[model samples]
Target: MRRLLVPLVLVLSVGGSLGGCGWAGRHAETSKPDVFQLQGYVSVGGAASGVPGTPCLAPTSVPDVVAGATVRAADADGKVIAVSSLDSGVLAQASDGFRCNFAFRMKNLSGSRPSYQILVGDRPAQTFQTRELTEGKPAVVTVTASS
Candidate 1:
């Protein structure tokens, strides 16, 4: 009985250590994508230059100027995780320029490197990896609108 107990204890200890060390490296992969804050500036005609332009400028304008635009984040599986329009409280103006920031949650996302398609209004959609769209560093998307 003593001999059998020793081997069982050793096996359990090793297995516990291996499991604690993140076995199969699956611990790093999230079961479901996490909800992250995604904030960025959306300007018609061109991108925000981080410079306060003159009033009635060509590109920069008030927050309501882009109130009709929408921003969508689609996961790799083509699932729309978040959709934020420039209407209401989602739009704001900073010292630099007008911003259309939103809380973007992701779903159906896996793998070490997950990416999403960032669609901004009528402009071309931009692709960004999860690592590149972290907190504090917002993705800048520009679009051109017709008269």
Candidate 2:
């Protein structure tokens, strides 16, 4: 009886450990989603065109300018999920006149949100559906601002 009991205990112990390992792996995978990246461009239009050598206005400093401004991403319920800063503006000649283009990247965004609202500085937020923003594709957005 003692010999049979010893082998059964050993087998149970090994089986429990293996089952625990599998459970842990599945738990980790379901806990969170894969990392996602969101990229976009902000264009400021209806503003005085600046020369190549002139300093561009930062988005935060000006009311409508988006360059060098804080870009925030919010979920459908208006909860901010991710935040990033816009890069310096690159002047580009537009058909109307001139526009300042700024690029920004927000990383590790959750895929669970149905839509995303992007707000730059104090400007109004822009809404984008989940289908509009793919995992690796960059979304270009135009923001019109007057100087």
Candidate 3:
């Protein structure tokens, strides 16, 4: 019983260490644990995917912007563990505190890509360029303005 207890204790300790948000650094992208990602979007050192929605300056034909980006450790049942909102642009890594990014697109009347800013958590993130939509060229204006 004593020997069995020692092994069980060691195994439990190792498993616990491999659990929780601490594992975020390793499985940040592989598992959904503390993971969230949207398509058409780009993130650094993590997961990058496309989000469903038109640029901020989308035309009437454009639909609502849907942000689908995140990463989190979840259960086998697909239950959420930790949810983190993600933005597809430039990612800033903090050396001390926390930093976040956000953006919103507005359909531009001009054909040129419009520069805009997005607010996150009451704070405005840096400016990002996106398709504003011009006259009629393609069925839907497609732009990939990166800052």
Which predicted model would earn the best TM-score? 2
Tens-place lDDT per residue, model 2, 28-126, is 465545456888878766545777434454344356454556888998878899888888777777788766677899887877777789887777788
| Candidate 3 residue-wise lDDT, 48-73, digit = tens | 22332322222222122224433232
My TM-score estimates for the predictions, one after another, are 0.45, 0.64, 0.19
In terms of lDDT, model 3 sits at 0.32
lDDT against true structure, model 1 = 0.54
Which scores higher on lDDT, 2 or 3? Answer: 2
- Model 1 over residues 38-119: C-alpha lDDT tens digits? 6655544433344334332224433334544567877776567677765322434555555433323333333244776777
RMSD of 1: 8.4
- The model with the greatest lDDT is 2
Candidate 1 off by > 4 Å: 1-33, 46-65, 87-113, 144-147
Candidate 3 vs. true structure, TM-score: 0.19
